[model samples]
Target: MIKLQVIGNLGKDCVVNNVNGKSVINFSVAHTEKFRDAQGNQKDKTIWVECAYWTDRTAIAPYLKKGTQVYVEGAPDIRTYSTQDGRQGASLSLRISNVQLLGTRSSDGEGGSSYNSGPSYSAAPQHVSAPPSSSQLNEPADDLPF
Candidate 1:
């Protein structure tokens, strides 16, 4: 089994469709990478991935809006097609098995706050312990061998 994981922002709002008695949520994600070329010139490249989440759980559709950050994991599918000028092109798509909402972009195109619960499409809420208090941090390490 080949699994692919991606963390990026959604390019547009998701669409939920009912096909043949099944529900599917379609969306796209864009990931950008920055690197220095041979001449030491910095460059940025962005890749867009089409995603399809076929599941009965459609409650998260409303949150999958444009500029929303998400972490998606699934089986990847590469498709090749002919362009209008008879050129071959390839596209990357995913059969999403899991998705998590990270954050949303602010109205001014700046960073925004994250979701408090951090809900996942295919899993339940995980237990996350709170950070240690100042007193706890100041305590001696009684179990240390040193």
Candidate 2:
């Protein structure tokens, strides 16, 4: 079995459709990487991956909006097709098995709300704990021997 994992932002909102009584959510993710070429020039390359999640868990579909960051793992597939100009092209696609929300990009290109799809596959806000206080940090360690 082959699996692929991707961390990127969604290009657009997800669409939920029922195909013969099975629910499928379709979306796309864009991952951009920055690298310096042999000439010492920096360049940004973006890869777009189409994703399809076949599951009864459609509760999280509303949060899969454009510019929303996510982590997805699934089986990868490459599809080839002929372009209008008679050129061959290929696209990457995924059959999503697991997906988690990272953050949302605001209109100003900044991070906004964040969520996570927990075990139940529900869209819920993640819990963040505060750092320990100075007094707590000064406490002695436990008496457990090494």
Candidate 3:
């Protein structure tokens, strides 16, 4: 019943795989923290989280590219194994329940653009249908003197 959420930039493009008739998207996210060390020296540490999203909705997979920011939530999992040098190492992974793209690094390499799952803003009106004609009226207008 433990849940974890991470907001960070994608390390690379997502991979969509078909395993036993089920589709799964795999990706990695990196979060960096900045702090001042004991000697007043600035330091940065990065944490990488591997994510696996199993769902039929693969439309979002195309957009999960490198340097793309996203928010992901899911059940946390820790995997421990022995490295090639006979050293024990552990990695953090998640079975994603939900994910959202936050932004994308701009093509110009200057900044980035924000993203929203909701509808975009438009200056024009959405409904363009005309009003009902007199023949379509259910009831006549009330006739009264001013």
Candidate 4:
């Protein structure tokens, strides 16, 4: 029941590796944060997460390039190791089960659609009725603007 969801920008181009007749794609993503401190000073921070997606749909590999913003969900794995400087380090890794392509190239200045544009937007009118039939259209023109 360990589930993790991450939304971030790809850190580098994804690589596909084949081992034991299975395909695995490895990629890293960076998620940034911006916040105001106690003094109202702006601050920014970024978190990096490693993801491994094992799927036969290698077609998605090319799209998982650097700078691609994506949403991934899966189980989390934390590992600790000793660094060369005799310091202990731990990293957060994810074995992604579901990956969604979020947006297009940033250089193009046109990103992908967010859920805001979908039918679920609250501002949109609910259950728009269909146009009137010919009977309703037969009504005499009451407007004098014509």
Top candidate (lDDT): 1
lDDT of 1 by residue, 14-112 (tens): 999999999999999999899999999999999999999999989999999987889999999999999999999999999999998987776663445
Better of 1 and 3 by lDDT: 1
Per-residue CA lDDT of model 4 for 1-146, tens digit only, reads 99999988898899999989999999998989999999999999888999999889787888887877788889999989999999999999999898878764545444533322111113246787899975787556685555
- Model 1 clash count equals 0
Worst lDDT run of 10 residues, candidate 1, spans 109-118
Candidate 2 per-residue lDDT, tens place, 27-71, comes to 999999999999999999999999999999888899889888889
- Name the better of 2 and 3 by lDDT: 2
| Prediction RMSDs, each to the true structure | 5.0, 6.0, 7.7, 7.6
TM-scores for all predictions: 0.79, 0.76, 0.76, 0.72
Alpha-carbon shift of residue 37 in model 2 (angstroms): 0.9
What is the Cα-based lDDT of residue 55 in candidate 3?
Answer: 91
- Higher-ranked by lDDT: 1 or 2: 1
Which portions of model 3 miss their true places by more than 4 Å? 111-146
lDDT measured at residue 13 in model 2 versus the true structure, 0 to 100: 96
Cα lDDT listed for each candidate:
0.89, 0.88, 0.87, 0.81
Which of the predicted structures, 1 or 4, would earn the higher TM-score when compared with the native? 1
Please report the candidate that would top TM-score against the real structure.
1
How close to the true structure is residue 107 of candidate 4, measured as C-alpha lDDT? 51
Regions more than 4 Å wrong, model 1: 108-122, 126-146
After superposition, which runs of candidate 2 have C-alpha atoms over 4 Å from their true positions? 107-146
